[model samples]
Target: MSIARNVPFETTLQVRDTCLCLHTQRAARALARRFDEALRPVGLTSGQFSLLNALNRPEPPSIGAVAQLLAMDRTTLTAALKPLEREGLVAVAADPGDRRSRLLRLTGRGQEVLASAVPIWRDLHAAIEAGLPASGPDNLRGALAALSQPALR
Candidate 1:
């Protein structure tokens, strides 16, 4: 008998058996979609927002370092940056310390766009926090940190 023929509809659709890495992934995805929609006015995908935010921290970070911080491969990260570069939100420049290295920097326009998106981000964050409690966002952040500590080592 075909497995599909015998299984109940609910059984067929259940994600519970797949060993989901993060139960919050669904929530995260939903949150990202909402953020993406809200950020549409600023012309940023959630992924781009994350990249911009990371690049905001320091200057002259090599492409490899940026990739490492984002937990992505150099090629994929480079691919993602293409649109950002094309839009003039970010720039890649030669690293003075290493001729072969390239540094990723956020542009002034990127900061402006990021600033515009901050209130929307804050709204989304507050919505998430409202669902929890006094310590919601902090506790969730802590949990993510604990979960990520091993991979970071």
Candidate 2:
């Protein structure tokens, strides 16, 4: 039952205005919504599109490798794969080298769906780029990549 200190509104305002995490999270949410709407016709959310795209590789990638690439934990990646697997869009196979490890590959239907989504993605991406100022997209990408570096964590 000690004293309760009240935080000044100025501090809250400062954080809202200056926090990089807050800004990035807000931007991500907005971008996700935009992509979701744009991709609705293709029957995919932005996350699904990304996950499927990640599986599109010549050689199947291991679960751990994909998790690292997507910046998601193995558990989250596994959970995310379930729907795609159920839809027969992706297949998970036990790695020959390591039975304990699983590799992810896009099924034939997955390739077809991803191919369909590509033009939609390209159009939206170009629109986004056009809306940005000169070099804005590149600068933003560089900044995001820098922020995502493991060292920052």
Candidate 3:
């Protein structure tokens, strides 16, 4: 039998330094942790804050639409909604235009919670931006938005 060749350690180091997915995931997790701590007093996680913020529009969006915006699958979104629903922070109802399609909305309690969380988010976000290079925050956001495009998937 032919012997298998071993990959060089340098190649592993190169991937560790250069892989976009790895870097982004690490940053995402760190950011999530920071926000989670900041939001603890309000009893919300970063993901929950984001989900609630997305529903802060005048018109409620369909589940599919919210899933697309959040870059999550229907099942995952549905699972995430359970706790919020149980807390009476959100309501999922049949869309008036499409009976089979469900719409998601923030309840008054959700609005109250979100309002309470806003200043905390704002301060944390400002601190994060301040810690970045002068142009880093905008550049990083643009790069992330580009990567998050549906076409990229």
Which candidate number would show the highest lDDT if scored against the true structure?
3
Model 1 residue 9 CA deviation (Å) reads: 11
Q: What is candidate 2's TM-score against the reference?
A: 0.96
User: What TM-score fits each model?
Assistant: 0.80, 0.96, 0.94
Report how far off residue 41 is in candidate 2 (Å): 1.4
Global lDDT of each candidate: 0.82, 0.93, 0.97
lDDT at position 89, candidate 1: 88
Candidate 1: segments with Cα more than 4 A from true spot: 1-22
lDDT of 3: 0.97
Give the lDDT of residue 30 in candidate 2: 95
* Candidate 2 structure quality by residue, lDDT tens digits, 14-49: 999999999999999999999999889978889999
What TM-score does model 3 achieve against the real structure?
A: 0.94
Task: Write model 3 residue lDDT over 66-152, tens digit each, in one string.
Answer: 999999999999999999999999999999899999999999999999999999999999999999999999999999999999684
Clash count (model 1, backbone only): 0
Please tell me which model should have the higher TM-score, number 1 or number 2: 2
Give stretches of model 3 more than 4 Å off. Answer: 1-5
Best by TM-score: 2
